[model samples]
Target: MVKKDTALGTGTMADRITDDEFERRMYSHDIAPLPKEMEAIFNTMPDFVVRPKSAKEVSNIIHVAQRKKLPVIPRGGASWGLGGCIPVKGGILLDMSTMDNIIEIDGDNLTATVEAGITWKKLCDTLERKGYFLGAYPSSAPSATVAGWINTGGVGIGTYKYGGAGDMIRNMEVVLPNGDIINTGFDYVMPNGSGYNLNWLFVGSEGTLGVVTKVTFKIYPAPEKFESISYSFNNLKQVGAAIHDITRAPINPFHMGFGDAMHYEYLRKVGIKAPKVGSLLTVTFEGAKEIVKYEEKVVDSIIAKHGGKSLGTEVGAHEWSSRSYEFKVRKMGLGAIPGEILVPMNTFSKVLDDTAKLIKKMKLKVPMIGSVADRNSVMVMPYYLTDKRKFVRSLTTMGFNKKFADIAFKHNGRPVGLGLFFACNVEKMFGREGSNLMHEIKSAIDPNDIMNPGKLVRTTTGFGFDAPGFAMNMGLGLLASVRSLLPRDTFGEKK
Candidate 1:
């Protein structure tokens, strides 16, 4: 159990590092809202919480942690839902958000060097004033840190065309697990010449490898005509065909995202103005005005070929503007847990159909949203509203996500992030040899297991017990079955 008094603050920690109970409590959780009953297993509170304004300070802390053999959890805005930043065992928590600063912006080179803690929204807004923008950013850009999104998958708007974080990073400044600083690529040149292409390794490493202090990312000039248009389909078949054909078409849009009618219904339930349609695809076109106009014609032809009607520029603009807060319905007074999976375009219709069925089978009313990532894959997100006040019953809803992953897996897809809860899938996500190699790499770099231990490399409770993968699956399955048998959750349902 964590300490309840102020004595933890009186330790030998540096003046900047604090053991204050109030601050530690605040930093313990990101936005997950995990139940108090969970305190029995995972200890969220840290023995120390420090905000380092520079990479050197970060190095010093990591050195201290290494000496003491304590786990070091480096964090940004702490906006992610998964227990990525949450501590399984008590250790030092490095809050990087306070270090947010724009280091440099080379307009001639079209790159921005920023401290890892800056929010995507802040950086985007600042760049807009100077007529520049990022190639891709997280959907939670307003609050998620640049490093946090890059640490995760780094797929969002502009990803369909401009690619993800791994593709955009020209150079990355990372403080390794052993307090050594290294640059993965050149600051002003393309990173292609190379040896391991180290930047890609850290992009999705999830802080298990090292702490990213600064990054120089490739940027783009703000488009001359950045516009979005939408089309409504009678059903999922037409929607799927429209997306599939659009991918095969001779044009490339900046972004593509869609939602079934039920998704909009949930949005309207929360009073967000959304198009009332069975299903619709919103496509964003960017470039010269004439180019955008011509591309719109091509997209319209494809939509018409698939039996879809245009929703016009107005609704499309609203949809594009509201992309970041797609799951705002969570504010309707219940715990909202989202499950995200990525699959090929061929399995798009099947996945949506199965998602609808799973929702019904689980007695859930929430809906699903999808976005095109590239030519090969598309991401789908499904959310469920749970009354956390019910405690055990609410915890059981996690089975829906596990079952959700099963559906994605069967369709040649996988879930997005593997923080604490989903760490068991490491071996399944990667092949046996690949998984073993990843563990070996983790062990090699962080020999003491101090860099975000009990995470992606493996699963361990605060009690030092490792959770078996099959056992986790069975437990989740049982919980899901138990949840299905309980009385239906009637929150936000129409009378």
Candidate 2:
């Protein structure tokens, strides 16, 4: 626990706190490599970082943050492209990655209790060893934390069939901004029939509500089999149509993801072994052997009906295995900015068509990957490759995200999360009253407004100025328009 101090963080929570500039710089950003020029817009660095090993330690740290009235940003795997974990005011950063301990594996009760810092891959691997299954997990499981995914989008692999990470969570131990630790939901049974689901309140809250220290997730007995199959489509619209048909069918797939030929072409350019098919869709079914076999046949008929051809099981398994490394081609240039959006099946094809046109008009070398988030929603992520090393050019690339969100809005869809980059869209997505209420709720829970002070609700700069909502939209639009007039990219073309 940190002692009340006027100078800086003092005392000890197992002596894990650090005020060193070198270490503080590391906690400044997440997966997205923002250019140094962004320093002019915000204070991306943290003044201090503390690695809490237990919920009690986390609470202790929060208590100190309250006394000092400093913002406490909870950081897990740091895999999010958004600036959810970045501190705008350069306060204390709670590094949760080290507290990854599996506290309980209630096999009989079908629940696994673990520290929130546990990576999806680690938890899933551990559960598999006990003959249990983690039905829903993020595709970025290799580094994404359980709490991180829940806070980000709350949707990932097995989302279409078993629902998202929120559906599996039975309970969570959260440390509020006031340093009080509370548990939401039940231990073994599903939480229900309540006035409001407190668990859901924290879900997709983007760490502004509180720090999720521990969690209990409903687990399943290992499936008897997992069957994967792939199909090839002539174009992205055709692929979307087939997905629409398949999702409308009676059967439910464990997971389904697709990629256009251009995406694979880029992958192949980087020496990745991707199928040359114009468009690829991979589907997986998990359950009893007989049921999975039946599902494979049902899906085959659907694909055949939609002018698709089977790509054999080998390619299917390959695609499934590569879910976490979707952007291996990032090595070709600077890593991409993934504009993730969720659109309904009705407009999915149109969104795909328009997005392709948008990419062409912007003169970008982009590739798209999509998946069925649920029966009604599909998640489309367009990875626009850009050279962030070229300072001014990198700033222009941000325009793509703004324009992309506009496209989603036009088609009655929306961007995945309101992280720092997309904070201005809160009103557009949640409405004026709802957006105001969201900020009120934030103030209600965090009186000091120190829990991730500059994200989601609105962006704040280190200079203690809020980015005006109108200016945000206006600036983004102008940047995008400017990008449209810029020359085309040939960075990835064979020269």
Candidate 3:
């Protein structure tokens, strides 16, 4: 039973508290009403879902949680595909969507100051009307928030040209667990001091250190003209080579993505089809009209050299749009678990080939798609249909992830925070040292571990990986297998 929040209580978000008081504090956000399949994973149901309308309200909620030593999980749009946003400890679901307000647009500085709750789609819509744009467009754009995007280190369709979401942020305002509001660098917009960059610390911390109240991003001028094209290759090697060659060239495509032949066939089953080939590449570019035309010619030459058959301009754009939102479509049908992994440039071909082979070996049913980054390596999202073969697909998903991590690690590649199937297995994947570092950071900022505990970082078990709840549902025996595989002191000891 949750008790009422008495006193101002640390001056955070909500002035009042308790599960019974939820109806009054929270408004318009859905409860834990999740599908049966997801309930088992979420563990505990949040006692209340609070929809705060302002930063003060957010701070108040944090203060209340801190006073009560209760856990609070911040959620934006509630469109997170992974279990990251699910409140495993069951306390308060701080829905930030209500605070969706675009604070200001500084055209002179080429930046936009926005609240954490503002949706990316809404922001982009407003920017589009003004002939300006935020460079990154994660596939979740229709429902993903700008703050959520930054918090999770989002990689979008335009990442090939613009870089990751972290690269676009200039400064931000974060509220730490101690109820201290700190402005990182965005305060320097008016000029205070020019030493040390602290915004990056909170950007990818994934809401562990603090609750992000507002964000400032470096926006770019919208391209005057844009073109999308798709090409199909009879072989995976050719497709990989084509991606490498095209990206390595002078023309920088705004978006570049790839899908295996099986993936295209799966889309065809649902009345959507790319050019017939073993693998397909979809490239979209934006620039001045003449520049787009010239780039198109150059891209075509590279495709021809790699034995890629052009599917023309019309079909290509449609394909790119469809591919961009493919995950959403998959959700409505079979529902897919994404496997997002980044790799180094030189070994990209091998990674792609290895990923394809893993999917084949697992005999899982889903599309395996990838987006190239500067011809170095690709961020792969392999869709696994969870509805058909639940247990088998789940196990296969885990296996495929292990394959990706093992192979990528061997190739000197690192994971970009999260992945699809094993989204919450960062500690397991990275090992003890990495896990401890993440936990220590969380502890320093949130000593009581009141903010989204067990989501990104976990507490020390004091008894190795076999610690209580360490295995969760994976069982004690399987935990042994997993523990055996992790490198001891994973975060690394000096030298």
Candidate 4:
């Protein structure tokens, strides 16, 4: 039982704690609805929610939890549906959104430091006004927090050239599970001679190890010239070849994204006038005008050699400008089951083909989006959009989502982030040795298992690829057939 003392044995910081019903309900889940089939497993809600304004206050709260042997889950904007911030074991939910502050922008060092709760859009807008920008951001930037993305190993708009959030981070201040504060990266004052890269460990640890209080990210000057071009390919193989050739070329693109034929069909239904068939690839370039123009010429030649037809600059520019809006449109009162799989460039074509086969076998129609992270890898996102009010459809969607993740795993692709939903695959994702090392580190830092206990480690068993049986598959097929008869507008629209 939690101590009812308002002082919390740590003085004034205890006032931040609350067990209000309204707040607990609000913090219960994320954008993704809880699967009805697994409702009984995750039925327990958080016992209390705490909002800390400063690192000192956070330290106090964590120390109390450490002593009480209570679980603590750190929360940011809570925009993602991956269950990364869910308080599964009913303890304390650390709401970090209240710590929204941009602390510093060091022009000389080309770095920006901010509190954990600040949104990516706010940071990007602030830096753009000062003639600087983030190296990369997530698609949910408008609502996703800096620390949240850092914990999830985010990738987005500018990833093609600068890599993911991990590559852009220079340093960070983290509150350990035991309430001790430590600074990672090169410290100008009181440097430690450990010679270990501790900063990267927290990048994708999903907040199971500690609470990130502050982050310093490497920023870049705004590009002088920006241009985009689109290409239409007749087949998935051609699309893969085009991406491979462009990535290998000397020209570095600011962003590179593509959609399969089904994705374009969905766009057309939403009145975008997208192509009826074949794949669409969009490439955005930045830098000096002369250099951009020269790169576009070379890119055009490469696409032509790969059997791609130019769709002109108008379509590409429009798509580039509207990339972020897609998230908002998809989530407008609709149920969406989204998953991201990271695969090597060489297996891009095979992954696409295999995913198409699975969708066909399951009799499900969904839109898939792909992005080239760098020369060697790509990220593929396949999402199912359905009416949230339909109970059968929602449950079926969850089952199909698990099957899709299994397909990615079968093809040697791993999840982009391991939230509660993907916890079952931790061994497959990190291998036995890596998973054991993670467990060892987690045990050392949080011996009592107070920090996000059920995530990133195999501490609990719940719904996953093995949960639902043949009955769920039959239900999914029936629901898919019924959904086919409904109008496309039955799903939501951007407005």
**Candidate 4: regions farther than 4 A off:** 1-16, 187-194, 267-277, 329-333, 386-393, 459-495
lDDT of each: 0.83, 0.86, 0.66, 0.76
- How far out, in Å, is residue 274 in model 2? 0.7
**lDDT tens digits by residue: candidate 1, 1-495:** 233233222333356677788988887877765777776888778888888878888887788778777788988877777778888887889888977899998999999999999999999998989999888887889999988988886678889998987888899899988999889898888888749888888987888999999999888889898999988997766888888988998888999988878778878889999889998799999988998998899999999999999989998999989988887888764657778888899998898888778777777676677789998798887777766677877888888888888888989998887787887677778878989999899989899889988887687788867788778778888888888887776767666
Ordered from best to worst lDDT, the candidate numbers read: 2, 1, 4, 3
The number of the candidate with the highest lDDT is: 2
Q: In angstroms, give how far residue 424 of model 1 lies from its true place.
A: 1.5
Instruction: Pull out the clashing pairs in model 4.
Output: none
Q: Say which prediction, candidate 1 or candidate 3, comes out ahead on lDDT.
A: 1
**Residue range 180-251, candidate 2, lDDT tens digits:** 899989998888985679888899889999999999999999999987888999987888888888888898
Error of 3 at 181 (Å): 1.9
> Per-residue error at 319 for model 3, in Å?
2.1
Task: For residue 25, give model 1's deviation from the true position in Å.
Answer: 1.5
True lDDT of residue 317, candidate 2: 88
Best by TM-score: 2
CA lDDT for candidate 1: 0.83
TM-score, structure 2 vs. true: 0.97
Q: How high is the lDDT of residue 272 in model 2?
A: 84
Which 10-residue span in candidate 1 carries the lowest summed lDDT? 1-10
lDDT of 3 by residue, 364-462 (tens): 454678787655767766655544344433432444445555567666675555411233456655677877776677777788887766555542221
